[model samples]
Target: MSGPVTLPAILARRAAATPHAEALVIDGVRVDYRTLHERVQSAAARMVAAGVQHGEHVGVLMGNSVDWVVLFYAAASIGAVTVPVNTRFKLDELNYCLKQGDVRVLFYVDTFLNIDYTQLLRDVEPAFDAALPGEVLPLLRRAVIVGDVAGHDARAIPAGVERFDALPDTPEWRAEAAARAQRVSPEDILLIQYTSGTTSFPKGVLLRHRNMLMNAAASALRIGVQPDDRYFSVRPFFHVAGTTMSLLVALVTGACLLSVPSFDVANVLTMLDEERCTLTSGNDTIFLMMMGHPEFRRERIHLRGGWAAAGPEIMQKIHDVMGVKYMVGAYGQSEASPNVVLNDWRDPLELRVAGWAAPHPGLEIRTVSQETGEVQPANAPGEIQVRGWSVMKGYYNKPQETAKAFSDDGWLRTGDLGVIDADGRMRMLGRLKDVFRVGGENVAPAEVEETLFSHPAVQLAQVVGVPDARLGEVAAAFVVLRPGTQASSEELIAWCKSRCANFKVPRYLQLVLSFDEIGMTGSSKVQKNKLRDYAIREFGLA
Candidate 1:
């Protein structure tokens, strides 16, 4: 049956249809659909009592928990936009997002992952204790702490901050929340998802309720998700892969979501085996880490299927080594509500593992020449452009960027290079901006990384272009060897040089412990832009 277009309506429908079914599972704590619905209602009422209004942004700065889920849906129910703050952000980054996102109310934890969020907030606004709304963050008035704040002398709940458990949930506020939900339209902005700022400051991508709801349902349908399925996902909720693809997928399909506050490989492997999850999701880095972990046992894992945004080698590993036979590859950015292209689980294994897939239903995908404005034919590489139900409304508060993000004809410029086959399946080449020229030879970092990944000792490889005197730009790579295995710079470069073109081989290769030294997004993506800067400094090119 075609479900409701709005999140609140879908939650209500699921609650009514399967009141006793488990909807969320975290740290052995389970929340059923009915209870989840009630919690969201109470949270929505609290939002109303706190003076949150329709169309205003409510920032969520907590880890993945029942509180995060409740606050997210609560804001949505009241027609307020949820701006999920990156949990890894420092004081400056946090300040920028809160200010740029125009967050009027914020729901955060006092402490998470050993980071003092209360102190960070104080750093963002020095007078946070003095007033409800600080001078630094003019729009932010209401601050609610969600997680445990007791039993720690250093971590005291700040003054004037409301506790999540202390929020008023009266009948009058409930009525107002329900009335607000009724007024919410599918076209209303549901989230202002901030992009991972790899190159520059992150822009808030405006996504509507319809865009997210449709994408989630489509993803769940593609994976053949069942109500009894226990889907395990370590992808953080701050990202779209976690929100629309994981959480909303569970909500729409009545499946149970297995969530974690952080990525602990040993704990995740244990949970995946103990809980007997039917489905799971992650990118290349996550899958690699799991397989490389000593605790990973293929026989113990009973996954049926899940989606990934990975390369061909990693996809193959996820299928063969990990025993996720139905693992499908996907391609997307935050601009398209994150899942523009996805592989159907029913498709052939090779196609599913090919790191290329068909576009979502009703999503129009086309390839246009980056040099020229003309469209390209099938099998020709060009800029991937999309115009569809899943495309975001625009970048929030960035009129020039929003206007530049799309073509004059209204198609969203993905800034990714890809080729659409005759069968209409798209193979992503690489990011348009990431492609570099070495002595007039164009090099896509994916092409180089693919060669490096084939090496037996290499666990993960991230390649970026670095400035050079003669060639203008040359490839620089950071290699992460398997846990017990080791590969030297000269050795891996030789392996790549033997397989790839001369210019495509990394001119400078650095062996690293992990992407942590460089930095990775919550979704496990290596920030290429940051790596590039690091390389420039390391090689003294700066």
Candidate 2:
């Protein structure tokens, strides 16, 4: 039987198709499809009582949990667009997304992984303590806490904020929610994914029900997902890898999703063995950490297959050490609902390890020269471009960036160097854009440079990606201090750690005399390639 395309319809159909089947497993809680659907319905009704309207942005700032899942589905059921916040975001980053996303309602946890969100929200807007939405976040009217704040009584909760459990649930509101779900169309905007581009600020990529649902189905097809399968995914729920690739894949296929609140190598290994997980997925960093751990035993692992975004060496290691014999390669960005191309598990090991994959049905992939906009022949490297049903509508509220994202003919410019073989299998060469990935997280050099520039003693800063054994790449910095000012490399690195996410922090820092000493063009633009080469040799990273 064909499944539904929209999120709300998918949950309902899954509940009817497999009411008693285990749909989710998180934090030691096992929820079946029927129970999951019922929880979503209650949450949707509460949203209606809170005065949330259709198409309004609902921000969810929490780690992976049953509450997060329910809130996402609930928002979709009532036609509200979910704006998932990155748990790694600090105060400033969090505030930026809240304002840029135009969030009217926010559902968050008091704390997760020792990060005090209650304090973070208070820092975002001081009026949060008084329960009154402030001018800082004018669009935000309602705040809902999903769980209790540690060491705090119920009365201590903020005045304007409401507890998720306390949200009103009535028959009338539930009926209205269901009616709203029926009106949801596949073309309706489902979520606005904020991802780091080749700029200092992150841009929101608008995705529709058809874009994400179809991508999830395609990933499920490639992995040969089955109802009896247990899918373990450590990918954070805030990322498209979690939503479209893991969560929706499970929902569409009736697979039980073994969710992780936070990634712990020891805990993950224990869960894989105890849960008898049949499938799991992650980048090289995750797989390498698990295998490198002393607790990892190949005999105890039951994972048969899953997709990975890694090079050939790591793919081989995952197969040899981790025993994921059918592991396949993947390629995508947030703008394409995150899964433009993925290899089939049934393919040969050599093909699967090649880092090339077949594009999803109805998607087109080609390469064009960087210097000229002319298309390249098969097997020749060029800038990878795509166009199809999966491409995002556009970046929210950024018309110029959105226009630059596409070509004159409408192909979405991927900004990655790649090649398409005669067989139509696409393989990535390297990034044409400066944006680099650190353990599956995209890090824009401009974002890090901006953070470094905030330091008082720093006059100039340039960031680059350097090779690492554990993480695929880590940030390295070259700094030119202010006149007569002195700052140690450790001090500058520590300054960044306090200001930005861990992945964005520079692991290595070098004090340089000037940009001219490194390399500069006629326009005085710092040549990043030359700096990266210098860092590689100086740090012995090559």
lDDT of 1 by residue, 35-71 (tens): 9999999999999999999999999998888788889
For each candidate, how many residue pairs have backbone atoms clashing (under 3 Å)? 0, 1
Judged by TM-score, which candidate is best?
1
Tell me the whole-model lDDT of each prediction, alpha carbons only: 0.89, 0.86
Looking at candidate 2, the ten consecutive residues that score lowest on lDDT are 519-528
Q: What TM-score, to 2 decimals, does candidate 2 have?
A: 0.82
For residues 199-268, write the lDDT of model 2, one tens digit per residue. Answer: 3567899999989999998899999899999999988888888899999999989999998887788999
TM-score of each: 0.97, 0.82
Error of 2 at 343 (Å): 0.6
Q: How accurate is candidate 1 locally (lDDT)?
A: 0.89
